[model samples]
Target: MTTIGDFMLGGHAACDDLFAQAENAAGDWPRAEGALGVFRDTLLEHIAMEEEVLFPAFEDESGAAQGGPSETMRAEHQQMRALLEQMADAARAHDERRYLGAADTLLMLMQQHNMKEESMMYPMIEAAAGTRADELIAQCRAIELRSAGTCTCSRHGAATA
Candidate 1:
């Protein structure tokens, strides 16, 4: 069975790969910007899946709507969104230095955020949501497919490219 953890981990890896591609493009402004665009889109899709589908399911199942880890994660998502905008602007201007700096900060934030979700939040969700977990993951996969315009969840029964 494909778990939420597995699904999210795959997204994390894919996002990292995209970022690495951007970083490797380095002096090539067009290539770097293109890769960053893909990275931003993919990351946003992952965030949306969690914020729109998983988090709500988790909050309902765990009864932490008022305040909890999900709230903290949501806040982090906002911070990341701001950083993504900054990075996008930097890329648009072809400011590699600025882009790298923002990318570094964003990477650190994402690593910490991902760890919390994978280690703490996902287990709580799995235990609380039980059989419904699969359904929620499927929903998340659908969101990814729609946002990415490509499949990113082969394990969840979606085509992978």
Candidate 2:
């Protein structure tokens, strides 16, 4: 029985992999465009899983509607989303320097954010949710990802939307 925290961690790894691919394809607009699109879509899906499913459940279970770690995570997600937009614009312009600049910042932010989630936030959530953690994991799994190539999070079958 994989926990919700574990599942979300896997999602982070998957997104990281996609980000790396996009970074590797930078400067080559044809390749970068496709790679970045997949990365962005996949990351968005992961964010959706957290925001639409896990965070709400965690809030409900823990009764922390505001000023919680989830709120911080949400704010971080917004930062990452804005960075994604910048990366996309860079990709469109075939600007390798711009793409890498944003990627560097995004990667740093993601690493820090993931550390907080993995070390502190997830353990706290698991303790709070107890048996309900399993239900939350199921809800996260049900989030239909963009495509087979994009969803490397769980190693499960591709859950195409």
Candidate 3:
């Protein structure tokens, strides 16, 4: 069903979608500012998901060296936050060069981050979460949607998409 891995995967895809939209707009998007806001909100929410829940779960489960994946992911998230701040500033200034460069950097970082979670961390979380895995995943899914304003993030009633 909805494991943290799956939830995070969807979020990564959403980030990619926002990135793609921004790239298509390039130096001419009248709404580039709003678009960047959406991207920032979505990215921040995704990072928060990992920082608040998934990373801890994985840390407790796998126990990789030096806290392992969770540790690395945290550092990456911090790096990403910095990049996002820079990108946001560039967008606000309408600096095409800076925005595009930051976009390229973010795209590479995001793809790599997605790969790490999908390939390494997710499986561990799945096994570790066990019977509660479904419940936790459900919570994550709700958060994703709520962050999107599509619905509430509570484990009440059936989820749509």
Best by TM-score: 1
Candidate-wise lDDT, in order: 0.83, 0.83, 0.73
Residue-wise C-alpha lDDT for candidate 1, range 64-90, written one tens digit per residue? 987798899999999999998988888
Ranking by TM-score: 1, 2, 3
- How does candidate 1 score on lDDT? 0.83
True-vs-predicted CA distance for residue 103, candidate 2, Å: 0.6
CA error at residue 151 for candidate 2, angstroms: 9.5
TM-score of each: 0.89, 0.88, 0.82
Residue-level lDDT of model 3, residues 35-150, one tens digit each, is: 67667777887787777776676667667538576788888888888888877788778788998898889888978988988998788777777777766666665666666564
Q: Quick one: ranking by lDDT, best first?
A: 2, 1, 3
Please provide, for model 2 over 7-91, each residue's C-alpha lDDT reduced to its tens digit, 9 standing for 90 to 100: 8888889889989998999877898888888788778878888898878877988898799889999999999999999999998
Which candidate number maximizes lDDT? 2
